[model samples]
Target: MQPRLNFYKASQEAYNAVKNLENYVQGCGLEPRHIHLIKLRASIINHCAYCIDMHVKESRHDGLSEQWINLMSAWEESPIYDDKERALLTWVDAVTRVADTHVPDSAYETLKAHFTEEDMVKITVAIGVINIWNRLCVGFRAMHPIDQPAKAA
Candidate 1:
């Protein structure tokens, strides 16, 4: 589907502000893989194909195996994630679905056990940033690029 509007062109200032937050998230001391997981998990929840495509590529670039990436969507059922990743995924769910979850104390406490206060704040912001992008992309029907089929060798 074509995008309903070009957010960057519609309001450069607004888009730039979001970009600034994105930059901060990249350097916010969280591991790159964790950041990718946050973005991907939230995108999955929001059903934003654009973001799912982007973060999956980024996650792969950061050395996350396809199994790790795919299993994240079913993390609770999978035995692959470590304690810290489980905590991170829990918080991503809590914050991404805050309306339903109310950002539960159990999730927060779980995150706190794995991260410092600063790291927790950064992670929350990272989640918020992705949610923001998810809304914009979903609201606008931002279409992801189609991949060409692999050519025969």
Candidate 2:
């Protein structure tokens, strides 16, 4: 599908502001895998294909196994995730669907067990950042690159 608009080109200053947040998130002490997983899960809930594709590629580049990546949508039932990962995913769900979930206290309690207060703030910011990106990309109809492998010819 064709894109509705080039958001970055439309406003480079605003785009750079977003990029600055991304840079902060990159060094926020969370594992790269965790960051990507959060991004992927949030993107999935937001139905942002561009972000899903981007994070899947980033997850792979960070050496996460295909099995781990494939189980993202079914994370609640999957055994691959550790306690911390599970907690993060739960938080991602609660926050990403905040309108519906209101980020229930139960989810916060669970996340607290896995993350320090500072870490929790960082994680929440990361989630918020991704949701904003999802809204922009989905709203603007940003197209993800096609998945086909390159031709040998």
Candidate 3:
């Protein structure tokens, strides 16, 4: 599919805002796999092919097992994910699919059980950033690079 616009060039400020989110994700104590999982989950909710391809590949590069990545879409029943990971993934899905499933109190309570209030805010921020990027990429049809591979050695 053709992109509607080149947001990176057309809106430098907006691109910077999105990039800042990446910086925040890097600085957060969350593991690379966790961050990538959140990104992939958000992309899936938004149906952003560009992001799904990019993040899925990145997750693999970061040594996230293919089994875990494959199970992410059905994380509720997947035994590969730990308690903290499960909480964060649930949060990601709820946040990304907010219109359909508003983040319930149970989600918040579950997340609070694993993360401090500050960490929860950070996690929310990370999710929010992914959601924003998903919207922008999907809206603008931001295509992934053609040479990008699904996995890297």
Candidate 4:
């Protein structure tokens, strides 16, 4: 489905403002892979096929193996991810589906064990941003074709 508007093109200033957060998050010591994971999790929670397809493509560019990427939906049962990655995934799920799960103390403590305060803040911000983007894409019914590649960030 076509979007009601080309949000990126129609509002360059607003788009830049959001894009600028990427730079800020980068400064907070978040890895590119973690950022993509956050995006993928949020996309999955929001059921945004456009964002999922987009982030999956981006993740592949950053060297994420197809197995790991595909296993993200079943991360709990997958052996590919480590405890830190598992913790981050847990946080992503809680935050992305906040209304359903709420941000639990266990998840917070788990995340805190793996991430510094700065990293935690950055991760949360990353999660928040992706959730926002997911909502926008889902609400607008953004569509992606199977053969098309994601546009670069």
The prediction achieving the highest lDDT against the true structure is 1
lDDT of 2 by residue, 24-131 (tens): 998989878889988999999999999999999999998999999989999999999999999999999999999899999999999999889999999999998999
lDDT of 3 by residue, 1-153 (tens): 899999989989979988987797889897677788788888887898899888889889988889988877788887889999888988888887788788888888889899889888888888998888888898999988788457875
Question: To one decimal, what is the Cα RMSD in angstroms of model 1 from the true structure?
Answer: 1.0
Model with the higher lDDT, candidate 2 or 3: 2
User: What is the Cα-based TM-score of model 2?
Assistant: 0.94
**Model 4 off-target regions past 4 Å?**
148-153
In model 1, what are the clashing residue pairs, if there are any?
none
Which regions of candidate 3 deviate over 4 angstroms? 147-153
Report how far residue 15 has shifted in candidate 1, in Å: 0.4
The residue ranges of model 1 lying beyond 4 angstroms of the native Cα positions read none
Estimate, for each residue in 65-112, the C-alpha lDDT of model 1 and write its tens digit.
999999878999998899999999999999999999999999999999
After TM-score superposition, the amount by which residue 93's alpha carbon in candidate 3 deviates from its true location, in angstroms, is 1.2
TM-score against native, each model:
0.96, 0.94, 0.90, 0.87
- TM-score top scorer: 1
Residue-wise C-alpha lDDT for candidate 4, range 59-117, written one tens digit per residue: 99989999989988888999899888999999999988888898999999999999999
Rank order (by lDDT, best first):
1, 2, 4, 3
Better of 1 and 4 by TM-score: 1
Q: Lowest summed lDDT over 10 consecutive residues: which window, candidate 2?
A: 28-37
Alpha-carbon lDDT of model 1: 0.94
